[model samples]
Target: MNISHLLRQYEQGHRDFPELNLAGVDLSKVMLISVNLTKSNLMGINFSRGFLTKSNLSQASLNWGDLTYAKMSESQLIETDLTKANLTGAFMVKSVLRSAKLSGANLSYSNLRGANLSDANCCGANLQEINLREANLTGVNFNWANLSKARLSCAVLKQASFFGSNLTDAFIKEADLSHTNLEQVNFQNSRLSYSNLQGANLQGANLQGAKLRYIDLREANLQGANLRDADLEGADLTNAIVDNADFTNATLRDTKVIGTQLKPQTIQKNLSELQLKRNPNYAGSFELLSTSYAVAVFNKDNSLSC
Candidate 1:
């Protein structure tokens, strides 16, 4: 059916449109609330500014469609194929997108607060500045995705794969990222305070200048991770592997780390190397008082004092 015919039918109180093949259609700014478009083929459709709230789009193919600024809140998009679709600035709050294919999609500035995207393939998606606060992202594959400046506070991200992702400056406070694979992720300057990262794989990840205060890092791998200038105050790192991990100038005040294998010189050299590289006026007379709650004395000449 044509767009005009569909609108006429909708005006007559008819809302069912299942299995409809509306490929390449221009349905921009159309109000399709509570419409059933399940199993429909909507590929290449221009749905920009469309109001599709409470719509049933399960198993639908919206691949390569333009959903910019679309109000898709409370919608059922389970198993939907939105691959490479432009969903920028879409309001998808409380929506269900379980196992949805969103690879290479541009969801920048989209508000997915309280939404469920569990087990979804969001690899390589551009989620910059997206607000996903309190959303359920469990087992979601965010590999190589750009989540810069995204807000994921209180989100359930258990077993999520964020390898090679860019989460710089993202606010992920109080989130559960247990057993997640976060290798080589760029989390520079990010705030993950009070988060549960127990048993999470953060090897080779960059946590430089990040705030991880009061976080749970029990049994997590930190090998080769960059914690330079990062704050880990009051964090529980019990039995966490810190071998060769750089903790230069990082705060470990009241941080728990039972049976850590990192040598005192190796940990201290992290600071020495950074100071030497950044500044060449080192006095070479530094002393680390303790490793548990790391204690270091500094001099007025910009040198570590005993």
Candidate 2:
């Protein structure tokens, strides 16, 4: 209670400093705008370059807190623990941080535009180059998070997990990330344009040269997925599994292999040149195919897989 009697009782305006302990306080570059400091322990507190705009700091512990270059726009920080917090280059526009814990947090290059951070845990978080445009981030866990070059355009990220996550070259345009786990996720050279990723697991995911235009990926799994040189123009891939999927030199113009349980001679022995746009005994008929060096081999009692 001794930052000069909490800045002389917050300069005689006394904005409700609930349970304020302020352990290890430095309070560098302090402004403390609209401050509440609710349930504050503020362990190892530095709050580097601090302004803390519209600050509440709800349920705060702020373990190992530094908050480097902090502005924290519209901050509430609901359910805040912020374990190992550094928050480098924090601006945190439109911040709510609902259910925030942010395990092992670094948050490099942070902007966090329109931030809500729903159900946030952010396990092993570094969040390299973080911007998080239009962020709601529903059900966020983000396991092993680094999120290299992260922007996350129009981000909602429904049911997000991102196990062992790096998200190399991540932009993730028009993002919803439906039912997201992103199993074995890498997303090398990532763009993810028009992203939905319906029922997303992305089993064994790498997605080399990943742009993934017009992406929906209904019933998505892509078992053993690599998708080398991936383009997937007008992509839908309805009822998708694609067992042993590799699709080398992948471009897939007008791509939507409806209810895909692939076996047109395993796309002609690993796609030496298969261009049947329709009628390969067309099962209730579907194909907008134009492939190059493709490999799809799903036939485990296929009628759109189990």
Candidate 3:
């Protein structure tokens, strides 16, 4: 059925329609509250600025749909296929999207506060600057997603895949990120105080200037990662792999480092002297180790060596 027919039925207050097939239709600025869209094939449909609050779309196929600036609050979309959907600037607060397929979707600047997104497939999605505060994101697949400057405070991200994701300056304080894959993710200047990051894969990640006070990094892989100027006061880094990682000018006062495997000389001594004062006990051993690994880490073009 076309959008005209749907609008006509909506204006008449008819809510008994069990199935609405508006696939590939332009439904911009239409109001569709409390509508039943179960099992509908709505691929490539345009729903920009449309209102779908409290709608039931269980198992519906909305792949590649344009949902920009749409109001979808409190919608029930269990097991729905929303792959590659454009949800930019959409309002989805408190929406239920459990088991939904949202791979490669563009959710930039979307508001999803308190949304239920457990077990959702969001791989390669563009979620830049999205507001996901207190959202349920357990077992979500967000591999290669862009979450730069996003606010995700108190969000549950257990077992989430964030490989190759850019989370620069994101606010994730007190978030549960256990077993999350954050490899190569940029977290520069991000606030992660009291966050749970146990067993997270942070290998090669850039965490420069991040506030990590009381953050948990147990068994996390941080090899070759950059932690320059970061604050790790009272944070846990037990059993973490920090080999070849840079901690230049970082604050580690009373930070837990039990079983932390890192080359102490990886942090440059001459480039900045305050960096060496943070860990005063490593000055003698760092000098010996730096002479051994300096040629390997830095090439022959290196001029920063002591």
User: Least lDDT summed over 10 consecutive residues: which range in candidate 2?
Assistant: 297-306
* Per-prediction TM-score: 0.88, 0.38, 0.83
Q: Per-residue lDDT tens digits of candidate 1, residues 1-306?
A: 888999999999999999999999999999999999999999999999999999999999999999999999999999999999999999999999999999999999999999999999999999999999999999999999999999999999998999889999999999999988998899999999999999999999999999999999989999999998898777777778877889776766656665455444444464543332122232222222234333333443334433
Please rank every candidate by TM-score, starting with the best.
1, 3, 2
Tally clashes: model 2: 0
User: Candidate 3, 195: how far from true, in Å?
Assistant: 0.3
- Global local distance difference test of model 2: 0.80
lDDT of 1 at 224: 92
User: 223 in model 1: Cα distance from truth in Å?
Assistant: 0.5
Candidate 2 C-alpha lDDT tens digits along 1-306: 789888898889887887789878898998878889888899889989889898899888997899987998988989898888998889989889988899889988989888998998999899998999889989889988899889998899899888989898889888999878898889888899889998799999998888998799988998888887787776788888878877665665556667666544333245444443344553323443433222232232222211
RMSD of each: 6.1, 11.9, 6.5
Of the two candidates 1 and 3, the one with more favorable lDDT, higher being better, is 1
The whole-model C-alpha lDDT of candidate 1 against the native structure comes to 0.87
Number of the predicted model whose lDDT against the real structure is largest: 1
lDDT of 3 at 170: 94
List candidate 3 stretches off by more than 4 Å: 261-263, 267-306
